[model samples]
Target: MHSRHMSIVIPDTTADAVYAFAADPDNLPQWAAGLASGVRRVGDTLVVDSPMGEVTVRFEPTNRYGILDHDVTLPDGTVVANPLRVLAHPEGAEVIFTVRQRDMTDEQFEADCAAVERDLAALAAAVTV
Candidate 1:
């Protein structure tokens, strides 16, 4: 399995604020900045349309933290697992978003990671200030 980790620190945000920002996908464009449009939910999953492509992110949240299982569906009908995590840090927050690229090109994987990193930065911005 292929994996990548990405994280960002929020300067002055509370845990609740950080969690709220990261948990809501609808608030993505407002904060995430990269997503110019569409995001919807099915059960616990969030489907987003990004400049890179369409990716459906699924999550399971407990009392302590949440785990995101993503699936990026290509225009040609290919799909892959996108694993990630959103943890509430004592001082800020940390997110690790990974994509498996068994059949994907190197560029696609890098773009996806970049998208996630941008999203994480925006999330931190929204929560902190």
Candidate 2:
């Protein structure tokens, strides 16, 4: 029910390259520090070792466009849909993430937004490096 969005721009990179990297769930840990660790594939599932515990991440099927939407299933079985996208920009590329402010306190929501910013920064650094 909570709807918010955060984004970052990656310089000197094409949307194609950015999507190529960001679209892969296995590359999440390198950028998403909140996950606490990298993801590994178990059959068709991508599992992440998060601070809250193991979480399952399911990404949309691959496409030429820069859509990187995914679903995160928490340990408690709550599924959070994360709408993410990469778009071509004259400056290079832009990565956007939607932050849903579910039942959390205002402070918690702020922290979540901050975490998304951090993750986007990490992603920019990883791709630009």
Candidate 3:
């Protein structure tokens, strides 16, 4: 199990307003830059579509937080589980995306962190400006 933490600050933005986008799966590509789409329900799993490949993603939201679980299958038939959390921050929001990979290395985890960071920035920009 590998864990990484990421945060994005949205100036003059409320948590709920930001969450409306974060909570919606259809809006993922808007921020993630990957043309990703998902269902917003607990059991509704979203799939990110790309020419390289496709990934099945799911998100679970609580009264105070949200969790996104993604399973990406490589063209070679290898699959990975990436679970992320979105929590309320004092000033903005926090997203903790975790990955449990048996065949990957720490460097891969770092790359995943970078991906999440991009998403965070997108999330902030979507609501602030």
lDDT at residue 96 of model 3 (Cα atoms): 60
lDDT for each residue of candidate 2 in 21-119, tens digit (9 for 90 to 100): 987776777898867585789776788999889999888888888888888999999998889999999899999999988988888999999999999
Instruction: Provide the TM-score for each candidate, comma-separated.
Output: 0.67, 0.94, 0.68
Which model is ahead, 1 or 3, in terms of lDDT?
Answer: 1
TM-score of decoy 1: 0.67
Candidate 3 positional error at 59, Å: 1.7
Candidate 3, TM-score vs. the true structure?
0.68
Runs in model 2 lying further than 4 Å from the true structure: none
Write the residue-wise lDDT of candidate 3 on 1-129 in tens digits.
655556666655666677666766667767875445442333565556654466555455444555555565555556666675656677766556554446558887677677778877787777666
| Clashing pairs for predicted structure model 3, backbone only | none
lDDT of 1: 0.64
RMSD of 2: 1.2
Best by lDDT, which number? 2
Decreasing lDDT order of the candidates: 2, 1, 3
RMSD of each: 3.3, 1.2, 3.8
Point to the candidate with the largest TM-score. 2
